[model samples]
Target: MTTFSNYIPQSNPPLPPWETLPTMYDLPSDNPEEPGLPDDFHFLQPLLLYLTFQPINWNPELVYSAADLNLYYDIQHPLWYKRPDWFGVVGVGKLYKGQDLRLSYVTWQEPANPFVVIELLSPGTEDEDLGTRTESAADKPPRKWEVYERILRIPYYIVFSRYTNELLAFQLVGGHYEPMNLTHGCLLMPEINLSLGLWQGSFRDIERLWLRWFTLEGELIPAPTEEAAAATQRAIIAEQEAIEAKQEAIEAKQEAIEAKQEAIEAKRKTEQLAERLRQLGVNPDDLDEFL
Candidate 1:
């Protein structure tokens, strides 16, 4: 008999040639390169990224993957690359297949584009983030504002300034970003089913309002560790209550047994007194007349 493997036809798409792919650390020329930001800026970037990864209800379906703060997006254009301080892409698989890992996010290869982009403003890129001036308007691939708001068409754009403790949120409307007003330092993103706000709490020993996500009712979203801790506390309380109830039942049973034994002893003593009167031979019938 002919082997089944030989009968089946093999079909596979040809992989791209190695020469077309750029080498590691290959950054585009037009990319706004901020080699070094302030220490506080660096510290806040990872914290915000971690907070985004923590909350359970934020992305129940796990559509987005919270990528590293420094990973670059390799746009097909030779001289165009955009890297956000922190970014999240919806409708992308959490892991690339089983073996292939992403060194950098290439838009053509990835499943979906970034839905929201966050820029932690520094001294160098503050003006560009706010859409103030464009040095290479005609020559270069537009300004950062035009690229983020117009080209990429990202739904939500957030800029946070550590120097001034300022937070600004913009929502895409009519193919452009419009500044969104905040009520009590909170802006709701209905598309993502969450709110972006400044949370005042101690993270890594710093007490400040760090850029974080929250629920619709203005509750701070819980990290993975915090959720687990809450579940453990509830389990401990339930176990203690069960033990206390069991102990009470045991004590009640013991009290009931003791009461039954005392009644038996009292009945036995009364019977003995009656027998003693009979044994005294004083005529049980005559004892009633003497009384």
Candidate 2:
């Protein structure tokens, strides 16, 4: 029989890297047991949300934000958890138990559920993040959508796609999550007196479109570092203005002294002229009008 290899010919051209190589997400670690590695976008997008979230009506001490932290929801299961990309809580202390940093968020223990939850979409977890992924098994833990929508009943939900630069928002209305349209490139949440939106700017020296919080009127709520920088600038301007005022005062004083000297000299010359006129046998009193 003819060999199978003899009938197969070499390919005409080499396959491109896209076709030949595995993507980063697909390339598993040598340790299959190890957790998946997080890419740079995953690191940055959540940090932006953490930094810019400032609730206008809430107490700063009671406002807490978490990223990639396990949130235990069900008291019955006690082990069932959903780790959001980023979540913000109002009326919860930044510290766990009001004294220590949180290792993980326990929803039953906290006073309230998160006011807002944001997820940055990646190819690996896109379907589940958007709540479209089906149950892997009937008895497996509930999907993220069910946990947030039904169990926790989180007030606001947000998902952002880095590849397409798309942002979507949902609000809890009538016991269900409802899609909310962007008003002037922003989604306003009246409860917090703050808005969420995308802004094109540099953060951490990397320039890109970043999601940030804004005032309901669409004013950016500045980060703490930005607030400090602006305060420093104001101080510098105030110092410069004070220096200019001082210089102007000094110049005005100098001009007034010079004017006084000129008036004194003029009076002195008039008296001397009167003495000379008297010496020339002219009556100074009679020459007063001409002088």
lDDT for each residue of candidate 2 in 148-214, tens digit (9 for 90 to 100): 8888999999999878999988888888888999998899988889999999988778999989999
Clashing pairs in 2: none
Q: Which ten residues in a row have the lowest lDDT in candidate 1?
A: 65-74
Predicted candidate 2, C-alpha RMSD: 7.5
* Candidate 1 Cα misplacement greater than 4 A, ranges: 1-44, 47-62, 66-76, 96-99, 183-185, 204-207, 251-291
Candidate 2: stretches off by over 4 Å: 1-37, 134-137, 272-291
Q: What C-alpha lDDT values do all the predictions have?
A: 0.69, 0.85
In angstroms, the error of model 2 at 289 is 5.7
> What lDDT score goes with residue 115 in model 1?
78
**On a 0 to 1 TM-score scale, where does candidate 1 land against the true structure?**
0.66
